[model samples]
Target: MSKILDKLKVVELTTFVAAPTTGRMLADWGADVVKVEPLEGDFFRGYGKGLNVPADTGENPLFDMYNSGKKSLALNLKTEEGMAVLHDLLKDADVFITNNRTKALKKMGIDYDSLKQKHPRLIYATITGFGDKGPLADAPGFDTVAFWGSSGALVDLSIETGNSYPLNTPAAVGDVASGTNLFGAIMAALYARELNGKGDKVTVSLYGSAVWSMSFMNVIAQEKYGYKYPKKRYEVNPTAAPYRTKDNEWIMLTILDHDRYFPSLCEIIGRPELSRDPKFIDKIALLNMDNRKELMQILEDAFNKKDAHEWHLLLTQKDIVHDILKHFKDISTSEQAMANNYMSEFAFPNGQKAMLAKPSLQSDNLGEIENFRGPYLGEQSISVLDRLSYSKAKIEELLSKGIIKQ
Candidate 1:
């Protein structure tokens, strides 16, 4: 079957998670994405080494997850010949994606303004740590600092743990989210271009994405609002909290309508009488500090009497909105994930196999998206240059001069 983006050509000049993630998604949707790396390749190629995963075995799952289904063109952008090669590729390209800082992009003469003059129909998508006009625009930004730390997510989430030390965010969580947002913006630009025959420059920042992710809390967190952060578990609504089970596993409940579910929850926890008690009868009375504390204690004790799986079964039976917390290892083999094609196994060139996640979006037209390993450094350099109409002698000259790598 023809893929949704079969005819789209994307040139990706990026490293790390965010921009690469956008390129990966486009590739998954069937775009011919060419990843342009430096002669040393994307720095992320060595990321698996730091995690104790060997990179030499062609089994760098971390890199592959964000780079799969794309061709590689390792070039020396510092050289005029290499820059000429890149511009040639961009001449007929539909999109250009990058996460390089604006200063560096301008220095390399690939910034939006420079490219728009040449490739006016190209969709230029960029991801930054902060917005381009901010004081920190030129400053280095990573998911850890820009998304979680500066965006108030770190402090707000840490408050529930009852500690001054901030919690570390999971790896690339913000980058992936920001990348998804960039993908949406690129799709919108593509749609707009179809109507007006003009492309656009689209940008998404990690900090901005983080803030938008927390928009619900952000709006309520104003000084004029009664809501406040740093709330202890006991101080929160009992029906909407995490509880530890007898097996030491955690389960979270999300019963937004307390009045509707409080009685059922009380019955499930073997505290049916609490449903009748005026102090904890309704959501309003549960607002009382003492009443809330007592109910929390009762719920905690009740949850500890059953294993997480037992609670899961009970919650399913009662139709309560809840789920047992799962570790990363659990997700790989999750029945639901496997059933829904959220994860699948891929075999590396060396015959090593690993399960990897599919792109979040699913389409009936493009069922079961195929997974391919990421290209090696400059793996497609000759092929890409050949397709760009470079003569074999010129390609050899460029390679011999170290302007391109293979």
Candidate 2:
């Protein structure tokens, strides 16, 4: 089957999650992606080791998640020969993706300005900790610091825990989100290039992406609106908070139209009289902080009388907007996720099986894309150099000089 980006060629110079995620998505969509790594390989290759997974086992799922379906060409960009080889690859490339810091990028002479002069039609896409310009532009940024901490997600989300300690974000959550955002920008740039015969630079920062993600809450958090973050559960809308059931399982309710569902909820919980009480009769009454707190306590007590499964059935019958909280492991067997091909099962070369997630976007023209393993260090070095019309002897010399690896 023909892929959406079959004609696109991408050269990725990245480490860790963010930039590689964009390349992986592009590759999954049928673009030819060449991942350029250093002679020592991308540091991310060893990330599995930190998690107690053997990196040499050819089943580094964490690394594979972002680097899969792309060719690897290990090159020492510090060397002139290596830089020349990279330029050769970029000469016909449609896109260049990177997560390297701005200072390092400039030192390597692969910064947007340098590459733009050489590859005018190339889409230069970059992901950073902060933005491309700022005092901290060259500072190291990871999702934990840039996305969660600096963007106020860490503190805001800690409200549920009373802010005794900041919550630790899941691995690469921010990076993945930022990378996905960059992918959309790249698509837009691609369309623009098609019309104007010129490529553009696209930049996405982890901090910026996190702030955008928090915009819904941030917009209403101004003093003028009398809103604040780190709000207590009782201070929030009672109908919208999570409650523990009799079985100790948690379920979240999203009853935005509180007045419409108040009566039904009251009856379902055997508190029908409460709905008629003047103190909790309507949404306007619930707006009073004391009334809201009292309602929250009442609902909490009611939910605690029923098991999660029982509540699920009751809520579904009434068409109430709610869902049981699920752990990450539960998603693998989720019927909806499986039916939509959101979760996929794959076997590594060593026969180890794992469930992986597919891209969220679906297409009528193309169905599911096939899953593939990521490349080993320099796995495609020889073939890529040969494709670039390098003489066999020249390739050998470069390899001997440690300029390239295979």
Candidate 3:
């Protein structure tokens, strides 16, 4: 039998990363997701930062990841005729998602109040800059403000300090978090619908999601710690962080479980005497030594005695927390990811190979799928309209009037 979501339908009216990425995950789960786009299509079509693929003769890698396994229809919601098409589709849509501004949606009559009149059971989920009813609600949001700066995650890491090594986390921090918001809201709304016999409007914003994620830091700062990024964070954790081996290779060795592993670390480094030293004897005391120069200098010299690979094997056997600091290529070719089916080859529009996240499934229950890449602009407009029971003549008229793209 098909999975739980196989019989569901999702109407994705989103662009860019956050919202569309959530919709894509639903599509991968066997939902009949129809990606509604503007005439120009969703803006993420070229977000690959020059890593574009010419799929179906179109260059949109972001579109590929975010819209695969979904049908598409291009409609100009600003037009009366186009709104009619949306109304017709709403008659059967199980979930409707959009990332447009709240004011614009209300004006267009696509807001929850308006749509609920037509489809009372449709799950409505949305994303915004701040929120629909906050002072900063209308402020335009980008990934940077919402994810990096607002979250205070970057600030806590002390990334800006000149002495720190490579810092920034990958992109889509807020987007990823907000996507989680969308997914959770959808799940909860689905639950509510079963109980109340109606769907509800669920909303999340960049700022809200960022705030939710930074709760721990906020609590610590407000209560016990005067939270501030250290002037030189590496100066504090240098012994446990990456250091250049003799061959100029970076390696990280963390043996901070002082009472348990300090003796073993000392034996491994041939420094059996350091464990008995008063300066290094007290675990809590040394941690507050206020100066890690001695610790850093000793570890640096000890690590330099061997190359990264050699140290990796020796430390690993002793159960000492250590790593050679591998790169993305190392993980991509990793046997574990393949054995677990977390990553797999995807066929791009150009018939080239690409990496894509595997669909969620129990390993034994999964079956083959037609994993087509994303569509061109309005690629299935005519066919999609026909399926909606629109007459050919009326569809042509709407296209001619530019209410819907052909």
What does the lDDT come to for candidate 1? 0.90
Against the true structure, whose TM-score is highest?
1
Candidates 2 and 3, the one with greater lDDT:
2
TM-score for each candidate, following the candidate numbering: 0.97, 0.97, 0.87
* Positional deviation of residue 47's Cα in model 3 after best superposition, in angstroms: 2.9
Candidate 3: RMSD to truth: 3.1
lDDT leaderboard ranking: 1, 2, 3
The local distance difference test score of each candidate is 0.90, 0.89, 0.74
For model 1, give the 10-residue run with minimal summed lDDT. Answer: 156-165
Model 2 error, position 92 (Å): 1.1
TM-score for candidate 2? 0.97
Candidate 1: the clashing residue pairs are none
Runs off by more than 4 Å, candidate 1: 159-164
lDDT string, candidate 3, 182-254, tens digits: 8778978888888998988888888888788878777766646764554353355544677778788878878
Q: Single out the weakest 10-residue window by summed lDDT for candidate 3.
A: 361-370
